[model samples]
Target: MASGAEARDRLAQTAMYDRVESALNLVNERKSGLTVPNKWAFEARVGGSVSGAQLAITWSRRNEPEATLYLNNDVEPELAAKTLLDRTYGLIAASFADRIIGRDGARDVSASMLRRVANRLNELYTGRFDEIIHGQSLPLVSIDHLERAGPNPFLYHARTGEVLGDFTGLVRQALDRLIQRNRLRIEDVDVGLLASLFRELFSNTHLHARTDLEGALYRRSARGIVFALRPVDIPHDSFAAGLPVLKEYIESMEREAARPRVEFLEVSVFDSGPGLAARTLRSVVPADLPIEREYELVQKCFLKTYTSVSNPAHGWGLPRVMHALKSSGGFMRLRTGRLSLCKWFPPGMKDPRVTADDLQFMDIGGGSPKRHARVEGAVFTILIPVGLGN
Candidate 1:
């Protein structure tokens, strides 16, 4: 017979796993609608809601729950906004067809923010706005599409040179803003390399994200490159406990800095399609494959010469991005399918080139890989730290 303490510990663990599994099923299993719990438990569940809400909007069926979001009164507008704003959650929720209902006259701040951003995204997608809206004032050159482009259409209508130049310019501007805000100094060469990194990421989405697993164009999908800036303070203890791999890198940055926190310009490119492993393997990943095998398949994507496409000349993108991050001492987190992996590069590392082995399963504040929920699409978040300015 288990003691009371043991019973409580088991219950806690079960709750954690249940939360993770619920989020996964909400996205992957195609539930009728989303019911967002109160704000306290929302953070753990919102990631799944993002994808699930998008699915609800795009995959609506007759006689189904009206693709609605049922909200509770304990939720705050700002918390809901912030959670939805992370990655593509806000956009997906805004695109939802049915109403977002709040119980007991609770304010639906999420609905308002979603609508605002959805309008902006539509404007940007239709070329009415030259830049995308991150918030009310931050205009970024981004691409967001709620509907499918025609079959085999050009991903970007602009000329390759022009699009690349626009993307590079936006990246440079974003980095400049980060530098000014954080009083950081970055070299011109580094700025250009970072710009290239984003360009390649956007290019990658174009190459791999337009179709379903069977190569048919998706009738409805959410795909885009979005940017946001966040200030993060990873206390020494937390770093040591949860993310020891980044310890050296964080320490090196904080050595002479006045504050321990680092400001990161987050660049996230997400797409609703078959995820990285599925696309790389050109088939659905076997459901029974060990987690280790799944991790290996994701790592294979960063190999120096990996091309899921047919062209022999087009396999260097991911490796180049890896090398650039290693050189710039940046951090990246990739969530796709059942894997959440990350790699950190400290400045002046002995081997500037990243290999597949360097990728590790991300520790989600639990010191283990068990917390990861399967994401329907691929989401890659690249965090480039802004250093203290001279």
Candidate 2:
């Protein structure tokens, strides 16, 4: 019979193998394509077999207007978009130089516009072809490790207040457009607070996510922020069925605003590097550590008490984010490691309270939390609902 230590070793090896298999399955799934749950369906195809040395990544949207129209409330489509972008980045990192085809079969103007924005921010074909998109535009900010010469307006440094101010100015412009397009009636949003929230997220990515476990920058990486306005019918039963907190929040907003639908501005920040759990642990996590424990570590990072950085001033970023969201009434989704967590804050709440309980495991397609494949780096998506006109 095997000794206790040998048995434990065998278990650990089995777990490691399982994780590897899961990761491979995820990659295969992405290569095949992704189908969003409920109404939306977007497909991605990577690296055609006939392309001798080069690879091509293509994205197609199905179901016409619905597929291209709504994004923030649903988690699957957001994940699918990120996966497509990540795959493109991975192929570029592998030195595959070719055109990435982004075709919108629906041909909605907004869809085409959003695709252009995505292509620009991701630098999908930077410097190779005239078709390649570049330049800093409102609502999309492209952050890169390589510095550009001659006063690039979009280049942002997280610690510098002036750069942050410029970044927030662009954000406010984007938000203003959203309000005008949606015909929303409300007071000016706390852009300063919103800017602070973004600063913290950018700071975290720059400090922790830019380096490897051994503290080396990645040879090839992609990082940026993309903003979009999604119009959602309030009390969207199909989308909110699995998300109890969001359902309740939406219902409350409908009651307060007395409107059946609302528009939301989604701000998504992505980075390519080691994920949150890996950075916090600062070592190779043992297979024996349960996913629950890993999740706990990730959650702790949001608390004011936790700081992976040695400096005392560094840790308040995430907590401040929580505070801002709590005060403004919004939704946040965090994807990193093997976890997807979500939180929703109801609007016009007298009690501006936030606790760890507000953070809960995301219900994927109306199912309980399952073994999720690890996400490359981290993606934070925040949704701020537009107030309804009386």
Candidate lDDT (C-alpha), each? 0.52, 0.48
In the range 1-390, model 1's lDDT, one tens digit per residue, is 332112111011123324534545544444443444333221222123233332333333211344445443344654654444332443454454344545443445445655565555544545422243333123222333443332211224443322343355655665555445544455623566767777777677666655777888754455555555555564454332234444554566775345767655556666666788888878888878777777667777778667888878667777877777787677776667776666676655677766555554464332445425556567676656665432
In angstroms, the error of model 2 at 340 is 0.9
- Ten-residue stretch with the least lDDT total in model 1: 4-13
Best by TM-score: 1
Pairs in clash, predicted candidate 1: 84-90, 183-389
Q: Which sections of candidate 1 miss by over 4 Å? A: 1-22, 25-32, 35-66, 71-87, 96-118, 122-166, 176-180, 185-189, 233-252, 256-261, 355-371
TM-score of each: 0.68, 0.63
Clashing pairs in 2: none
Clash counts per candidate, in order, are 2, 0
